[model samples]
Target: MVKLATVPVSQVAGIGAQKVKELESFGIRSVLDLLEYFPFRYEDYRLRELSEVKDGEKVTVAGTIYSEAVYQRYGKKSRTSCRVMIDSTLVTAVWFNRPYLKDKLTPGIEIQLTGKWDMKRLQVTVSESEFPGNGGPAQSGTVQPVYSVGGTLTQKWMRKSITQALKQFGEIIEEVIPEFIMKSNHFMPRKEAIRIIHTPADTAEGKQARRRLVYEELFLFQLKLQAFRTLNRSRADGLVHGYDNEELRAFIQSLPFELTEAQKKVIAEIIRDLRQPYCMNRLLQGDVGAGKTIVAAVALFAAVKSGYQGALMVPTEILAEQHSRSLQKLFEPFGVQVGLLTGSVTAARRRDTLASLQMGLIDIIIGTHALIQEDVYYRNLGLVVTDEQHRFGVNQRSILRRKGMNPDVLTMTATPIPRTLAISAFGDMDVSTIRELPKGRKPIETYWVKHDKLERVLTFIRKEVSQGRQAYVICPLIEESDKLEYQNTLDVHAQMQHAFPDLKVGLLHGRMPSGEKDETMRLFSTGETHLLVSTTVIEVGVDVPNATLMVIYDAERFGLSQLHQLRGRVGRGAHQSYCILMADPKSEVGKERMKVMTETNDGFEIARRDLELRGPGDFFGTKQSGIPDFRLADLSVDFEVLEQARDDTAELVAQEDFWTAAPYVALRHYLQREQIFQGELMD
Candidate 1:
């Protein structure tokens, strides 16, 4: 039998070349793809008797035309209305801009109308029309699947083509899940589930079919993730670092601030990973300003104390330099050397840093993408730490790890990930989270204000600046855009300078050169520039202690996570910082975002709300964030199913014969064919 996935849609009985072109636009290419193209929603076209029909119900009613159609033309549009007799009662049927309905609804003609019945008007606003004997679903018990399509493909044609495809290839649709698991879950057979999903007898059956498919998607994803984890753990060449060094203990004791309980717990997890025989593939995540850097510092110290080099890679040069300075300060007393490598570093300095790194003189090296260059070599790279892990791609991380022999990897991020997304996106790695901020930290007071209050906000900023403090003014765009009505950074910079002529104002955006951005940030950090106006470029690890105010213009345009991150920029210092959200949002979602921001400073709670409002795709840019775009599975609502799938797959993969078992042969073959399994497991 020909495989459904191998057969092109063009080979289907009725889909011609033109139809194939149209289907390709919807991302449907193969017979399997055509069969799996599920509907976004369904319509109940089930025929109802006149006595059973209720007012305000979207239903289908068939009747015979009792009167001549009345047509009225208003400007470029026309209206057609007629009376139809259902049993003994008469009901009015109406259509807009449909002059052809007048001739179609002649006297004594039987017609079917599917639309809403208005109670007060005693009329059926017809959206679709059909004749009794035209072989349409005019009798009763008909459900229509509403697909997302366009460009020469009508719903009727799409339904017909899918029906034809199923008739030809439904039996050959192989079941990938094992039969024992199917019996345990009482799942519908794969073939029958596909059939019922497209043309179910009722809503209940459609729901059952959907549950089965959703479970399959999440289970397969979890299985692949577990397989990757198992493969990584099989290697025994990982370095086992020592964490009980006297200098490390002394350094921890000498810190100015105490570690939060959450930070201590996460540091313990990382220390445990470092002592294992296998490489550590761990993700350390926390809310912004949750003391993740201190925990990371401990882990890096352990690696260095074990007589091995450590590499810390970040997204931007500013963050790298910041980490370099702080770590140097923390480790200088302990005689641990720290090196900085960035794009803007002079060639001579970079050469010297590279030589020091190669000769093991640098105990810890911090850099941006420049760290991964060809010339940079490590003597004994034991632990690899990448901050803002989402900023770097999987290949870039793999390359950095490959610089040493099976070194342990630790990736850190300040963005709080919702529990469901963490499971689906980072399921292959061990996760450690820090949720509490250090003591003496003040919560940023947030307020949502209208645009008309801009002058008052400026006055507030002026007062704060006059008190010898600094402020940050953020905008959504870099320059003026006719397309988007957002306040731009350049314009905001000029306005701030004019608003407070005595205060030095600086401008920064992504479009600026690296050196200029660094300079602007330096001036702000040193209190030379009292007001720094910029875009979301300062959203991440740019920390200034004296900055006490963050004013966001057009705050409604940003997502909850982004708004939270921007707000986190301030409140890092001991001052009572304030985040003033300045915009009047028009949409309900925009208003809800502002409300959520003002209600809580907890990043995890905000993340949950963000996931609910924007979904997983837009939460972190699904394509770039390594989140799987499952067709039927929604991370927000299907988290329970996702948990079940993760557990089941993890248990199954732990079995000794999981890969070679007879019942899993088809699954193994599919995984291998999809490249979900590595070369060692290809047998």
Candidate 2:
């Protein structure tokens, strides 16, 4: 017999050609897909008699229709009212906007209504009459599962499809979980769990079933990562860029500023990793303005001085240009050759740059996504660095990694990830964090001011402008929207113009043309613009040391991480800086978030709070990256389970050679099913 997972949904009882589109819309093409579409919520159908029900209580009532329902008209409003008898008690059932129920509510008809119960005047009233035989048996009052349905698909249809998939093919529903794990975890068998998951007798059964599935998903995910890590480490050797401590010391001494202990520690870690023959997959994390770029430049310089090439891939054109200029200034003084190549560069210049890179004439090259082009070859590329690592997916990073014979990979992110999430998401990579800011970078004074104090903030900003300093005003929205009540960039821009008419004001948002945004950013980077009104586009790359004031309107509309990033724009120079959070938040959550920003400027602390507030999904952000997606597990709420799975999987990996192990063959097959055994990701 064909297994349930192998059966197609189209071959199911009621899923015809027309209904196939809706099922496919829900990402269900096979019977296994339909079975895996777990209910988001469940409905309890415990019976309650009419006399036993209390006022303002929701319940399921069983009764027989004693009188026919009528669509009685009252002024401009209409309704259907019917008298029902329940076990010697009389009650009324009312439905609003559903007058057609009159035809269905014939006399002597038995109905089970599940809805809100209220005492209207003198009689017990229940609205939202659910017809009998819709899903579960009403007399027995069994608990019901509510599946998510979209478009023309109904919940009844989904339940029916799942029923058909399970009943006819129940014998083919084989158990994939190893028996040892199932017994040790006190989990129900797979077949029993599936049955209860779809139609549980009560909430306890459903909870147990859901727990087993969630654990299965998380354990498989951890196992896959462990297998990939073991396989990935066994690849061919990488270029060992021997470190020169004296050259590094000279470079650091020549800099105008001194490196912090945090920077020195992380840099030393990188140097140690580069000396190893195996490929290095390390993630460098830090707060904004932690001097990550300079550390990277030094690492690349080490690779270059060892007679090898280096490539740094950033996320934007302007950032690439910024890095190119900074690198040229730093490396040229020591006779090191640096080159730039981007999509917008002239053809002649790009050809010359590519030729130099291939010929090893250029020591280090920096560019955007264009650095990984099909024709862009590297000569002895020893180190690969990706800035803003979250912006690149695993495949893009892999393609860049393949430019050389497994060159050491160093990915850098300014976004601070909470420790729990860092373990769950990036456990495969070695991590180094720059936890302290460089010396002499003054802390920006942060304040949370209500909307009524706007005038005082404007006055302060004007005073700062008069002192020959620039300011950045950040808004949550680019334009007005009926749905969102946050401040708009255009409205804030207009208000700034009205307040500081003599000052050069600029407007910037993501909706504007790229050239226009670049021009506006350039104007703000220099002293040409005194007050730049913008959105979060200036969150990551804008490096203006002269900008000493950052005023964020509707500050509660953004996350703490984002507010921190916006605050980092200022306090870059010696002048005292201020970050005024102007917000009139209504919810306690919003108010608390604003308080966190004002209480501390430490990003890692704020990130921990953010993880507590938003969970793991929003912690690393929605940006596509190498982090594996979890189908049923959340790292924030399920940290205990994640840790357990990590330890258990490590034990399994240590005990067996995955390919030939008999007891764990099912797990090995599952890994292959998920394509985790494929070596493309490893090599």
Candidate 3:
């Protein structure tokens, strides 16, 4: 019992060789592991007398076994039935599936069973039963923690093992929260919290235990984010560019379309960041078609006017080429050179571009990941703009920023997420949002078309294409999979080709070779392909303003935020755009998501709904490797706590010697034990 922390769990009292492996597979290798494995939920059961139990109620009743359990067969089904006597009242208990429980229901055995009261039949359906003579601590109270159990691991066995571990090693787990806070908040110590959480006397203790755990989870997360912030600022001295408005004004004036107030405001913010000594680590978030590219161009032009080169890093060659052409158009009037570098560039052309970049002939260079290649070097790089996919490709942007001497970085995301979630994901970076659509931009007409109305939807697409506009037919899958029952792009391509033989139909999916995909997209972008049958690969950076009609097949299979991104592909042109969702949602949540898609064009609203339904882990892409996986705290429900912890972290960091505090040391120790230590101090 005293050696629980450092000792291996295989050596624990009751564990055998076979059980050790099974427990280890559950990530429980040592006493420390077992102790930290908190329950996912709790079940309530209390001792109750038969007289006190009412009909249609569930209660724990103690009784004496009146008869041996017997397995009785009726026609094709068999059930195990037994009788228990509580005082003078007799009740029959039946288990439909668990015929193996006959051995445990022997006559003359004393029992306390948790079951539902069925007064009309005078029967109690035994849900869970445990014997007191089991070779482990009798872990019981009004509420019992239910762990996440898996193969060959019964809840009773796990409860017994965990109960034994708690009794043995409870003292080994230290209390990190200060004694004063624990007392004032009426929270038990970490040791006692672990004990009460696994076996709580009442719901209050369970709630208190969870509160303490949530506080620590959020506290550590804030500490880690703040630590990252400190490390980033101290990485290197930032390149400071002069504040110049004439060049930016010229570029803005040359634009044929007028800029919205949101665009103007974000551009000014970028200008201010460029003028500062510290490197700009900023996230630019604008709804689909809100003029983010224009802001990026304006910022890059500002960097160039300050007598330094800028680079724009996009995720794809198609998007990079589009940005290159757009930048050239923006900079040509002022005689600023914009060069393109992509894998598809001819070798000789790449050499020429590299030489030009080295000789400072190119004021701005735009490309895909090729921008970070060793051979390409900037003459005087001062700014790096990234067309991020909103998954926080932090490392991609970092590599591009490292191409310069701590160049100011601006990352642009078309996907609009909730403001609190944005803060959680990008706590180390400043954020500027553009929520307003540009002048003369009309909202896309969104509609939900059921399965039987597919013909009508196709007619609408045909009508739109007949008006000289293009269309995108998006399927949720690339190829048909036996596992998934949704339509795929390849089949849809064939269907479209047969249905509308007169119109040009092109196929594009992620499985296609990169060059082929690019060619297909090029054909679509240039209007040679009137209708492009594709998958969600076009959801990110593909832009075809002429494509005004979007028909999503199996629309219910995709998430709300993703559907919003798909809708963004259209509505870029002056013509009115239409997005028709082809769906047959059976579940209430799926139906609600489809309804939300039709209700609003606001990306943020869709993201908020997605957050509420799917949670933060999936909302953001997978967690970056360095980011901690919060075990107890959730960004959605714990937003207020996250804010408080963030404020507390700021105040704590401001102290002259905060790390020296005892409570701080204890907290830091816990973080170290979890392997995400608050970062080391700068040299």
The C-alpha TM-scores of every prediction are: 0.93, 0.84, 0.85
Q: How many backbone overlaps does candidate 1 show?
A: 0
What does candidate 2's lDDT look like per residue over 1-683, in tens digits?
Answer: 46666678888787799888778887888888888888888877777776777777778878888997878877877788888887777777787777667798888878877777776642444544666765533434878788878888877677777888778665567776666677888888777788889999888889889888877777777788777777676655567787677987888787777889998898889998888776778889999899999999988988887778899999777788778987899988888898888877888999999898898898899988899999998988999999988777767888988898778889898888877667667767778999998777888999999989989999999999999999999999999999998889999999999998899999998788766777887888879999999988888756899999999999988888888989998998889999999999899879989989989988899988888887766666664544556656666777777777777776667665556867777778788887875665432
Determine which window of 10 residues in candidate 2 has minimal summed lDDT: 121-130
Worst 10 residues of 3 by lDDT: 674-683
RMSD of each: 2.8, 4.5, 4.3
User: For candidate 3, what is the TM-score?
Assistant: 0.85
Residue pairs whose backbone atoms clash in candidate 2: none
What are the Cα lDDT values of the candidates? 0.87, 0.82, 0.80
What TM value does model 2 have? Answer: 0.84
lDDT of 1 by residue, 42-75 (tens): 8888788866878888888878999999999999
Per-residue accuracy of model 3 over 505-543 as CA lDDT, tens digit each: 999886787678878988998999999998887887677
Candidate whose TM-score is highest: 1
